[model samples]
Target: MSEPVVAVERLPHALDLPLPAYATAGAAGMDLLAAVSDGRPVTLRPGERTLVPTGIRLAIPDGFEGQVRPRSGLALRHGVTLLNAPGTIDSDYRGEVGVVLVNLGAAPFVVHRGMRIAQLVVAPVSRVRLVERPILPDETRRAEGGFGSTGTGVRSGTDNGGFPASEDREC
Candidate 1:
């Protein structure tokens, strides 16, 4: 299938920076760079959060949305990640794309201008209608089971706090 086209406009602050692009042929997301206006790095103290601007606007097509996701390298190495992971950019949004980054590590993290801080994934969105109903039909074997309803090899009778035990099978 042909790739969908997304229109991107660079603001004055990012005029010299390259547009978002995928790092590999099979990558699903395009890297989003930090566009700090002053050409200086921004430091994020531990337990702190800040909004970093991308200095660019996108014209996403109808029936699609932009998802801002965290870079795995940053999260694993520095405990830095998006405050609102998978932040959604609706098709009607017309303002600059900003990333809310949080530092969860013990040390401070620096964000330099044009640094690859996050990634943007354009995905198709499904519009669904909600219908009010008095009662819903039973769906499946796991219906209304809530969390930890499926066995995870945890002693079988103890509370798992809705989390799968270490011995849980990989999905």
Candidate 2:
């Protein structure tokens, strides 16, 4: 299938920087570069957070949204990551893209101009209509079980689907 076209506009401050692009043919997200002004770098001390601009605005098509995700290498190497992971850019948004980065490592991290700070992933969105009802209609064997309800090890003969035998009640 042909790729969908997204309209992107580089702001005045980012005229010298290249547009966001995928590093590999099979990559799912495109690298978003930092557009720090005047060639100055922004430093994030440990436990600090800041909003870094991309200096670009996107016109995402209807029925899709832009997802700003953190780069794994930054998280692994420097303990730097997006404050709001998978930051959502709605279709109606028309402002410069910004990334809220946080430093969780011991040392300070620096964000330089044209640095790949985050990634942009365009994905399809589903709209749903809500219909209120008195009660849910269906039931399952593991209904209502959550947060470690599932056992971590292999089930033994005495295992009652991750719950105690006495707690195995129907929904």
lDDT of 2 by residue, 107-162 (tens): 99999999999999999999876654334346545555567766554333423345
Which clashing pairs does model 1 show?
none
Give the clash count for each candidate.
0, 0
lDDT of 2 at 153: 44
Span of ten consecutive residues with least summed lDDT in model 2: 155-164
- TM-score for all predictions? 0.85, 0.84
User: Whole-model lDDT, candidate 2?
Assistant: 0.89
The digit string of per-residue lDDT tens for model 1 on 71-155 reads 9999999999999998999999999999999999999999999999999999999987665433344445554455786655433
Models, CA RMSD each: 8.3, 6.5
Q: lDDT (0-100) at residue 47 of candidate 1? A: 99
Error of 1 at 81 (Å): 0.2
